[model samples]
Target: MSQAPAVLRGQVVDAETHQPIPNAQVGVADNRLGTSTNDDGRFVLAIPPAYQQARLEVALLGYRKHSQALPPLPGPELRIELRISPAALGEVQVTASVVGIVREAVARIPRNYPVRPTQLTGFYRESDNEPDGRPRYLVEGLLTVFKPGYQQRGDDGEIRIQQSRKVDLRPAGQLVRIDWAGGPFITQYGDFVHRRAQFIDLKHLRDYDYRLAPGSSYAGRPVFVVVFGPRAGNRRADFAGQMYIDQDTYAFLGAEWHYTAAGLGRSPNRADSRSLRVAYQPYAGRWHLKTVWWQTRARLPIGPPLNYFGEFLTTAIDTAQAARPDYVERAQYHDVFLRNAVAYDSAFWQGTTTLLPPESLRKALLDQQRQQRADSLFRPTTPSAAAGTAPGPAEPTQQPDNPLGRFFSRFRYGASVGAWPLAVARAELAVAYAPAGYRFGAQTTALITDQALTGWSRVEYQYELTRELTVTLATQYVFRQFSGRGWAAGLSYQHNLRPRHRPLYGRVGLAYTCQTVGRQLGTFTNPDDGLRVAGTNLGADRLSLRLQTQADALQPTLGLGLELSHKFELVADASYLLPLRTRTQLEIAEESGFFLTRSSATVDLPAADVSLRVNGQPGSTLPWRQQHWLLSVGLLYRLR
Candidate 1:
């Protein structure tokens, strides 16, 4: 058995002002294990037995780095006071031009950042809120990120969600919804240095005007502050921001940027405002991304504006053991981190150091949980049926308490009407149940036209790869009004293009279907005499021809869904089926009809052995070779 790890609790504050320092980095010297102080400037760190003798270190921007021997395990909380560095106390002089300093910093990017692969462990949190600052929901996760160093171009990196939990704070009857896309990956994409953002890109230097601002400090070192914005008459430039560079080394330390009026004008969604901040920490002779904070606000079509906020805090870094994540572990760029998150683990969260949410959000979350508990208390309970007693009055079924059970118990049913673009009008009804990451469903469709009627019943299984992607397998039975039937099997994949938090979402799908269909052809009539012709007639006008064929097709589909409320959604889908290959078989049938009785005879014939003509002209042997298009619109109701 392994020994229990030692725990250290501490608070970091300024030596001169005695004020708490938020976002301070605390760790063991030369070790990969670390944590950051919360908003209260408090931190808790766990040290393994092997590292108990190592020194504890604390560092924050504009302060002097402090280190001391580890105190006894289980001791009282320690208070650490860090003094302001002399350089940051207005003691350093800068004589270089602002533009030159920024240029040198951009040029040294490859040398300042890691040149090889590196891994970082961090905490990610995102929140959705109303315009009035009421919290709607919050998602938190532990993430492991792997990235190719700055020397490599066009490589963004990979993220693996280790664990996560979501808390919904919306009150009962709240119908509005809002969410962010790309989750923690948004922070990765926001890394200005890694992405070579326009502001820092050397090629765009002439488009911006830069001026030296007041001096600042970061990571216990003085930094040169440079403020920049788009130059006059530069309509293409859309950002205004400040950059912090280390005074001695000229290495880029941090940046804060926001969209200017010109930028907001170019936004496709007409965002009211957007801003982001990124900071880097120096360790082991290289700089690593330390923190990222982003916020955005946009007006809704029918209500107040929605606000989104997200942050990522790196707690540990490892360069020696850095490697790419396996395919199953790597998160897709469109994946919603909360949907792909692992179940919450209380013990793990208790031991982890994470940024705490604001007091208002925490209180809202608590109230939500309390309401859930209060509601649960009034749920009616039923007696066991195996007690050899008569059944009691019917009552509403209770929701399952376990996560897996609850998921399986949830269901959705929908009905829709559509058309095949002048070919056939159709109505469809569908139902589905989800047990975990996968779902099982069934749908029945009816098609009608002036000349024919058709019905299709299908059973489908779908597995969710991410919140926005799903793979489907289905088998279907098709029946026509003419006493004809067929069987089909297909595989398809669907990807949602819109964020889940939006009221409107769009998706695209691709499928391959193989099917065989048999249908009876109406009796042939001679055009010249308007007389019926029989093949092997038991009686005139009673002879029927049947056609059976195999058709394989590739289908592409586009769909949209609009949330009507918490439990209902309106959906529409359109699909085009392109036939790939077809094989035909023909048969001749003769029927004898009597009062309340009928008899039929069928003779099979090869397509090559039979000849068909229409309007005195030869007809193609492959009759079911045409492509088809289908469209449908429906309403879905969720039941749980």
Candidate 2:
């Protein structure tokens, strides 16, 4: 087998200002093998043995192209600087109408761009953050894309994910979730030349006014810079920016534009602002899309503004080897790329030739991964030695020395307000502790309402299936002023939906609950005598009664959480209980002037028809064994 290619690392900067030049084209001269500098003007390229003697070229629009012989294998990092081209400084004058120049460039697209299919292998990255600069979601991947030539307008192209990793930082419990659905495919849609953006569309050319800006140089060729914007009173115009067109061939080199204020106002995505950049490189005598960068801020009605950034760089391109991706491998237009992320592969990232992410982003990604590992309930444990052999030294436990300190470190505290129908409202306090893959918790709740005094207490256990999912089992005891005492048991599944807002998370849960309603005894008035009475007696001056019930139900829950600080989160949840089975009983304790009747028979009743008598008169039906809804809002505090 042949040896692996030698790696080349370098940075490019302006020759005069010494400032780094981002997105500069860097590659082997005349070869399709190339890559672009990242935002920091840094790059990593692999040079095969065959290209050891070949020259490397670095070019950027407005900058004179730089070329030099390849450095020796395992050489020091290369630092190259490019000077501004004289032609770009307006040393050469242009006398043509800028509109005609732009028009000609648009007309030359069929000849300037490829007419046959091509394949691209590249790196893609997309990230979004909250208004305060907190990271929300990030996904980066290596991709294989199949592109139908510019002549074909209907084919949007296809992309296949090769390797990917994602980080989701949205905490659980959020009311609003934002998702950027298209992922890297957004780059394809941003290809204004092939997609015929309104500004470049031949039929819509008359709606815009174009003016010649300063001249420029791209890929060593002098180019004309034409700036265009909506004409006065043109309500349909949406974009304003500048385009680079080759002065000699009229081939469009690149363009940078942003949505106008009016366009932003009418945006369906509620965009606060949006901008895009698209560039092309001449390959084998035809121009091919080289890079796409897009950024946008969305002003949602709820929560802070969300910012998004997407970048696509063409690392290598192939026409001869181009082929369509398999149907199953193709990414759907509406697919959420995060759902397709695979396990993080350190090896692939280490060896791949891709654009380097910004230092801050890299640090954030690492910190997020570290935090996840720290918060994970399950951790790898050392295996025991074989049966016949003595055990090796026990692996050191990475924990605090004090047992009590370690024990208390696992606890979390929270408080919430809960509500149900029938004027019942409650305040709940809870505590939880997780020492391993499972958690144990308890809650105490006190109800305050006009009709009754009540309290509930519950103990629960939760087993984590993953970072974002859990299985829960709980049991509770309920006590009411007039309704007596009861107990319930339930099992549930909960999932966290990671939203784009860093401080918020949305949760969904389903549970099955089994409960028993104990005896409920209270005094009531006899309608005929105007005297206090209880228990099914309509004529007695005073009477007493008892009620009992049992029920099984399916409960569906939706919850939202908002982060208040590092140690606290505000959470709210709503749930509806649908009954599956119910059994009820009503017993008259005193009736017809009889008191403390020891031989009285209990009366069985249909749960739907049983109504409790209150204040010596008929009242609303008993809540036992009936469909109902629960709502709760609270704040959770982390103990450690």
Candidate 3:
């Protein structure tokens, strides 16, 4: 049986300007099925029979929301005029200079933003397109984001993916798949408003130079347009764009920015270009994120370009906690990758509001299957080793076997040459393998000295107990010509914190240590005994617990770490390591003046003060006097 949908026609326009407001959202209040207006501010909503009598809501970012009762059946166009929100009209004086307006906005964030807890329901989408802008992959998710409070230093919000779908459209022989797994996750962290100071803090005002453009209107509200770019003396400022600010409230209405020339050098992640546009609106006396759109184009060293686009739109807001936080927590969500998102009944998405049209989605899926079939016929079933052919490019969203990859990608090889405390020059080499939650790795270091190589080699293995926990076992052997020859073994558990700006971690450990100390000339247990033991080294054993954490994201210039041990004391350390410059070298040469050529490349060399450490440990020595500070600098070059 089929029921005819009730057609709701409407035109959304600015109340004062009488101009069409494009892309305004319109739908039945409280329902997921909704539609957006076109460039002409015209919308046609086909409401189901169940919602025919419901109220139709029209909303735009900067304008006041409007609602009206729907007719019983299909109706003629109902005109909707949205006025500039009264909340946006404030007593704040207008500033002719863009810099002044931006400064005021940054200063007023704590005041104008929501102070109490709030929850938001929104739709998120990630799409991939061919060079010609043909859609190839799409994933849509309905998510609930819970914010602790605006005044909080760190965002305690949680993003629960309520429902989601992953559509694959690559051809069979096409080993390349769109990077879709972490798209949603990236968008979640892309909430720059929550991380107030990270992108545009008052302290970083010097990084950007602002210019005031002519005033304009957005959603019927008067706006001051500010054009910004890197400051004359600052090369690190990598963003250039314009920001629209509400004239009366000094609040940000919208902004669009793209990577500048300097930014391209910092990102060697194949991101040739990147841009984002964001908008905010006042809802119930508190400002809220209305929309976020991010686009990027990645070009590999030897492949066609891959384009990625992601968007998030807030459809509803609940300041009173109407919806329970029953969904999965950040830890649980972090453990699951979006690439593994399960498919659901078509009825699932049919009930939800989405940006991608159904017809377009189906066509993309069919195209993927068609391309896969064509590729399967040409691609060899097995990989070739004799031909020295490298494997195809790994999918960007592919998950590592280790569950930790859910939080961050794992590294395979790394090397660092820096100075160690008491050692003028030292270098380290690390090779690790972590798959399926089992980890094995070895690290060795050598201290360059006048005598000989002196350092330690450590081998470790980790067994993932769960998504947030891991069991680790390790052993270390120290090598020194005239120093203590010893070995240490330990067992520990590491837990990674979740849903926060700064990476946090805690570990509880137990260890047994032994060191062969030089023996005294004579040693005897019994004073009166005529026997004495001599020329033998003494061995020592001990057990201890250690807890440590690093907070770098919160304060880039200064980082604090603390380590405590049951063996008797606490060790506190502070460090500052900032990169001065990042350099890259590319070289090309002809091999025997023929088609075959020998090649090598080095990508980045970041110079930083890698050895800046100030530590205080009262329980470290009997005399309570030891070296507590060390500073050194080094340059690290990549080799592959």
Candidate 4:
């Protein structure tokens, strides 16, 4: 016999106080029939005679909920009670019965396959209390979604996601975001899996032991309750909250997660401490997530004071349906908030990307792993004995002897001057004596010749020479007038970690300069000479030794960057007045860009000590004059 039609009526009441609860939700499991409890906590439900025997769910904000099978009846007026309780996260259960099903399902998924969730939009409703205790309102919403190339933390995208104080929200229209990264919007693809980068691990569902509990209802409809647990070995994946799954399918019916503190290797790091709920339904052979509710509860001074709550929902339907797949909204709602004795309701679709989690800040991980092979490992792997050519078995471990001895092997150098410490300027020359054993790189430098502040710089290029170190021999020419030609050169044993700039380094060198009395000032040459000049033109000749220090991003691949350098130059040069003494210059003549693009700003600091000797007189002219200070700014720009 067919069951009779029945109208089940009820009043929604807070289970604890038995007080009427307004705007509470009552619905059938996975079905579209649902209603919000009015101000009176009263609701009227019409049950079709054919649709009897379904599950009913009663939900309200800040409350414990209830789910039960429905019975046919216009029966007694029923009363649904919702109890308020602190949210207790459920534990995960992994056993023998359900692991296989999830494993099989996972194996069936293609790598990098964009799930349908990638295509759907998410919308939410929220209400918040204003700082002044005024009621706030946000209602009905829509969201549009898309796949975005995740980059750093900045929010520049098609659309963003949001949630409000209300207890529920679903997918609406226009904008949506999905990020697999630890931050908001789980949009990252599967390639991010296994990388020791961000902490969110969306790829380990099967490995994490996701499944329904043993006592769940398992009829042909196969209703079951499942929980999700984290995998060992890895520490955190946003510590996402627990999830409730449909026993019959791995589809998530509900989920609760809170973000944690900053991940390891992160700057100004922080974790997510907010709670969230996600719900899904099966449609057309695919699972469509329907709603998501997130409640923000962060710890003091650091966290947001007001507990934030937001809901999101979505729906897909036939062209002729009121909620058309494109035209009609299958979901509509508003943000709910009641605080400081006031309540506000407004639309949640208008969310700002301000608080959203950072997107793909790990470009380095996606970059193909490139480990430089040791010379031995690589060269040895190449057939050391080619057919017809016995390459002596290739002894890659040995360095070709520099037979040149100490004069060459014992000498190393480098020089630089930049914008910190003093706008007054700087310059340096580093020198190192290798076979000589002692490791200090001596320096001689100068800065601000235009301002009358003479200087000298020196340094030793030898520091920590190891298996992984590269050295550079740098030569710089400061102010050089045939009347006073002064040039400097440095030999530095630089260790290059990056093909570009080195953050940490050392230098040393023996430098010499001689300024003559050719009568006229000469070309100032490149950057190093424009500010400070150190030649033996001063009343006294000098020999100096010094050091270096720095920090910056190094792109060993791109082979490009700017370095901030500081140098102590120890001057070493007695003026060379010999006729064979040479002074030359590389001139652009007119087109300066011939050597540098518009993006580069290279300033050559002019420097030279004037010890005049009017034909052997002790005036400021002949002996090499070494500048005590020099500030030269080197700017480089790359069009590519």
Top-lDDT structure, candidate number: 2
Task: Residues 1-640, candidate 4: write the lDDT tens digits.
Answer: 3455578888888767888987555776433366556768898878876656788777543455567788547578787777664642332232332343333223323322223224445443433323342212223233443322222213222223323222112123213211111222322211221121132233544335444433333223333344445455544443433444333343434445544342222323222345555555555554444555555432334212333334544533221212212211111111112111122222221233212232321121111121122222323544545555655433223222334422232332444332111122122121221112222112222221222332323222332233223242322332222112234332223333343322332223233323221222222223221212221111112212111111111111112123232122222222212132332211112123333421211111111211222233433222223322233332221110
Tell me how many residue pairs clash in candidate 1: 1
The lDDT ranking, best first, is: 2, 1, 3, 4
Per-residue error for 128 in candidate 4, Å, reads 6.4
Tens digits of per-residue lDDT for model 2, 1-640: 2567888999999999999887666767443357667767898988888888898887654667688999887688899998987766442222124555666677788899888998877777777888876667767778788889888877878888887766566754443456677777965788888888888887777788876566567668777677888989996888999888886667888899999988888876668899998888889989988888888998777778889988787777888747787555677655667556355554565466434454533442335664354223122233554455554433321322444533443444555545432233232211111112212111222222344433444444444445456565656445554343333333333343433333566767787877555443444443443221224223454445555555677878888877664346677878787878866556444355655542232445533334334333443334333337767677765443
- Residues 1-640, candidate 1, lDDT per residue (tens digit)? 3678888999999888888887666777443466667767899998888888889877654566788999988789999998987656442222224555666677788889988889988877787778777656667778888978886758988888887766655554334334456778855767888888788787887788876565667668867677888988897677899888876566788899998888889876578899988988888999889888888898777667888888887778898857687655766655555455476664575466434354533432334663354233322334754565754533322222455534532445556554422223222211111112212111222222333434444444444445445565655445553233333333333343443333576757787877656555545421221221223323333434555556677878788877664456677878787878866655444343463443343333332334444233445443233338766677766542
How does each model score on lDDT? 0.63, 0.64, 0.49, 0.34
Better of 2 and 3 by lDDT: 2
Residue pairs in candidate 3 whose N, alpha carbon or C atoms collide under 3 angstroms = 169-368, 171-371, 171-372, 172-371, 172-372, 173-375, 173-376, 401-436
In candidate 1, what residue range of length 10 has the lowest lDDT sum? 429-438
Candidate 3 stretches with Cα past 4 Å from truth are 1-96, 134-136, 171-181, 186-189, 197-199, 267-270, 321-328, 331-337, 341-343, 354-640
Q: Put the candidates in TM-score order, highest first.
A: 1, 3, 2, 4
Error of 4 at 453 (Å): 26
Top-TM-score structure, candidate number: 1
Candidate 1: which stretches are off by over 4 Å?
1-96, 171-176, 265-270, 354-640
TM-score-best of 2 and 3: 3
